[model samples]
Target: MQFAIENALPMLERTPQVIETMLYGLADEWIYSNEGGDTWTPVDIVAHLIHGEKTDWIPRTQVIMGEGSKTFVPFDMEGHHAVKKGKTMSQLLDEFKILRKENLAQLKTIDITEESLNRTGIHPILGTVTLRHLLAAWVVHDLTHIHQLSRVMAKQYYDAVGPWVQFMGVLGGKR
Candidate 1:
């Protein structure tokens, strides 16, 4: 419901640092491990975030800002594996941080106003979209992934929690 770009930018700005602090010094095994099949490893999650930073947020903003007639391309959720191949986990983290910084810098330079925020564009999947909504989603997307990465990392000790797992909402997936 919030449309203040000033407020949302802080969230986007700190995501990389938050994630880095969370996952730093963990073993390579932990970074690349998941509970089992059909789940994302921490590494995969970071790759997905990087993919969004590249293709989703900034590009769509441009479309809504002035290129409303342009079609917003559908984002590939898991396609970055091939495109981002050969990158180490560290590289992905660093790249995400760099790209996010660039995007935030550009966002700050723009003339954002109520009229600009209300501008609309056509999304391939979501139909017509507004700049405000797109910017809001961009903030939420980073947060969701950060939470997901935390959950996956916490699940590494899912069984280790023993009987207390019943009371542990994170392990129980209650939240």
Candidate 2:
């Protein structure tokens, strides 16, 4: 689908609620389990979303707008591990909701236009990128994790599903 601020905002605004609906008050197994290896748990995904809200998206948008450093700071993809320690899932969800709300409000204040969306910034690793790309990534990033959360949670029933697993595309590694 085409990327527009109007199209993106609704998804962005609903992410917290989506996450909450999927995750809130679940058993510890669903919340804390991972897909093994280095894959993140549902809690980890929420923490990562919180970290992005605090560090990545809006700050980089400002950088593209000439309101901050010319080159964007390197993002720590796994930085959420440290911050989420000793915290409950409810705490992480609450923080993510608050930060996302504030960031969206700040984003709406910017006088965006076609030209502004096309304005550029230097990502420390990805090199030059446009403001439009950053905003689109923010929306898709939420979706990606939402997908991951569902996959991970469903996998919790991998063995329980037994022969039925053949019909479960999520368990088939389609992503």
Pick the lDDT winner.
2
Alpha carbon lDDT at 91, candidate 2: 92
Per-residue lDDT for 1-175 in model 2, tens only?
8789999999999999999999999989899999999889999999999999988999888889976567998999989998799999999999999999999999999988999999999988889899999999999999999999999999999999888888888899433
**Total clashing residue pairs per candidate?**
0, 0
Residue 170: error of model 2 in Å? 1.0
lDDT of 1 by residue, 9-56 (tens): 888899999988877677987898886898988888888888888898
Give residue 94's lDDT in candidate 1 (0 to 100): 89
Top TM-score: which candidate number? 2
lDDT of 1 at 119: 85
The deviation in Å at residue 98 for candidate 2 is 0.6
- Global lDDT of each model? 0.84, 0.92
Clashing pairs in 1: none
Candidate 2 stretches with Cα past 4 Å from truth are: 173-175
